[model samples]
Target: MDVRRIGVVGLGAMGAGIAQVAIEAGFDVVGREVSDELGTAATERIGHFLTRKVEKGRLAQDARDAALGRLRTTTDVSELVDCDLVVEAIVEELQAKRALFVELERFCRRDTVLATNTSALSVTEIAAATASPERVVGMHFFNPAPLMPLVEVVRGELSSDDAVATALDVVDRLGKVAVPCHDTPGFVVNRVLIPLLNDCVRVLDEARVSPEALDAAMTNGAGWPMGPCTLLDLVGIDVHVHASEALYEKLRETRMAPPPRLVAMRNAGLLGRKSGRGFHGY
Candidate 1:
């Protein structure tokens, strides 16, 4: 199906980024927020990012204005009824995501593609919440979705081939690469990346090297664009913890387990960049 109108069900970083990307791709975007405050904040956040791009000479002002014109925000999920595709980018909890899917099924047509932006949760479980499980799939966009080029097109057990093809088409329309993967904990990137970050945390917890030194080694010696510690902070420590716990629960692997220091940091409310402090202070 041709996806011209897109619905996004959260105003958090991921949702906002996905909305902006859709708007920039010339698709009308309707975003649902929990409150008026978040609605306003999401709009302003997207506007600010566009403004930055304009300032950096990466985006034209006219194009930014045009994209902004295609964007709309609301607090009602019913407003998304006209959307050809609805992507849920809310919290990581399975119950919350399932509940949202149930609510979405009420308003959305059975043919309208329903997708979740879940990083590590079960797409099969989320799809089970709706009657037309074949129409449900996982469209996992990375952090800062507009900037990230990779979109994981995850297929649930019952997801239809048409649903997956529609999702891949939408990703291509947004000028992003689509990687197909089965529904699994952490999908692809997180499944491999988080364990490396966990090892870095363990090294820090053991007091073997300073965070700066460890990061420097990875950046200078390994030639990584950003060290694992910095990437962890950028991705948010709490997010990493949750993804790790979810992986460990399903896989029962030591590498997927959240390290002791990660648990301590999350308990202390040091949730990385969003919280202003984590492995290193923002």
Candidate 2:
């Protein structure tokens, strides 16, 4: 398929980053938000990101301008009817995704690929909402989509080979590695990652390890680039909580249970760097 136009549903941090990266890779991008205000906010968010790259000499001003030129923001789902692919990056709720998929299928072409950016939810379940479930697949990109190299090209139970292949092609065109996996709760990365993150919180709450000490041990002893604490903060504590709860609800793994501290932190609105505070001060 000649995939030239990309539609990104939702304009949250991950959605904005995905849209920016797609535009940077020379695709015509239509980013949809629930409201015009949110559409403007998403545009400004991507603009600020591009501006930062130029200020840091990481992106050429001309390239930035050209990429921005290809980006279109919208508040209507019907505006994405012409998009070759539409990726949903909305809230982590299952009903929300299913409802959006129903609405998206109503407007988009039957062949237009619909991908979900869910971290742990069942892709098959989300795809069930669409009449053409074969076109619904998981295109799960890690946080900081611009910097993350891996894209999990998830094949749902009913997802067709062509749909998965299109997703892999899209990932390649965007200069990212694609790891195809069968649809499952959390697929692969988040299956293991969410549990570990939950344990990290448990260790802190139960073992009373200082966040600094725990982070140092993981960074030095475990050979991790960033410790759990710092990583949780960077990835956002609420995201971890959501993944934890989702995984636990799906898998019923005790280790995947959301820690009390994480719930408290999220309730307090300390959502890592974006919120100015998290496990560690940003």
Candidate 3:
């Protein structure tokens, strides 16, 4: 199935980014928010992103205007019925995600592919929320969907081959690489990356190293372009904590356990770049 018109549910950072990239790729995008205020904010966020591209000569004036013209926003779920595919980028709660997909299934056509951007949840569990489980799949894009190139096309137990193929085609159309994987805890990338990120946080707590020094050590000593401290800060300490805690609960492994420092930081609301203060001040 060729996907042209797309529906994005939830207009937070990831959702806004996804909508921007899709429209930049020449697809008609309809975005949904919880309220009109949020809908307007997400629209402005996308516009700002496009404006930055134009300012840097990365996007042309006409192209930026065209992308904005193809974008629409709404608060009603029923309005997404005509979309070829609907992707949910809502809060990372399983129950909430399940409920949204149920509503999406109610409004959207039977052939509309329902994709979730869940980072550390069960695709099978989410698919089971709908009568037509075969239409449900996971299209896990990274934090910055516009800049991130990898798209994990996850197939749940009941996800049909057609749904997976449609997702793969959509990813290619967005100029992203599609990596197919089965419905597994944390999927592929997060399963590995979470453990490493956890270790990074743990090291800081166990040692007396400053965040700057830790970052420099990794970048200069370990050959990593970005250090753990800086990377975690950019990724958001709370986001890393959530993913690590979820994986730890599911697998009950030491490697998946979140560091005590991260838990405390999350509680203190040191959420990195967005929060303006994480490992270092923004």
Candidate 2 lDDT, 34-116, residue by residue in tens: 88999898898899999999999999999999999999999899999999999999998999999999999999987899999
Tens digits of per-residue lDDT, candidate 3, 104-138, equal 99999999999999999999999999999999999
What do the candidate models score in CA lDDT, each in turn? Answer: 0.93, 0.92, 0.93
Q: Per-candidate TM vs. native?
A: 0.97, 0.96, 0.98
Say which prediction, candidate 1 or candidate 3, comes out ahead on TM-score: 3
RMSD values for the candidates in order, in angstroms, are 1.2, 1.3, 0.9
TM-score of 2: 0.96
Q: Using TM-score as the measure, which candidate wins?
A: 3
- In model 2, pairs of residues that clash are none
Prediction 2 global C-alpha lDDT: 0.92
Q: Rank the candidates by lDDT, best first.
A: 1, 3, 2
Q: Any runs in candidate 3 off by more than 4 Å, and if so which?
A: none
Cα displacement (angstroms), candidate 1, residue 251, comes to 0.9
User: What ranking of all candidate models by TM-score puts the best one first?
Assistant: 3, 1, 2
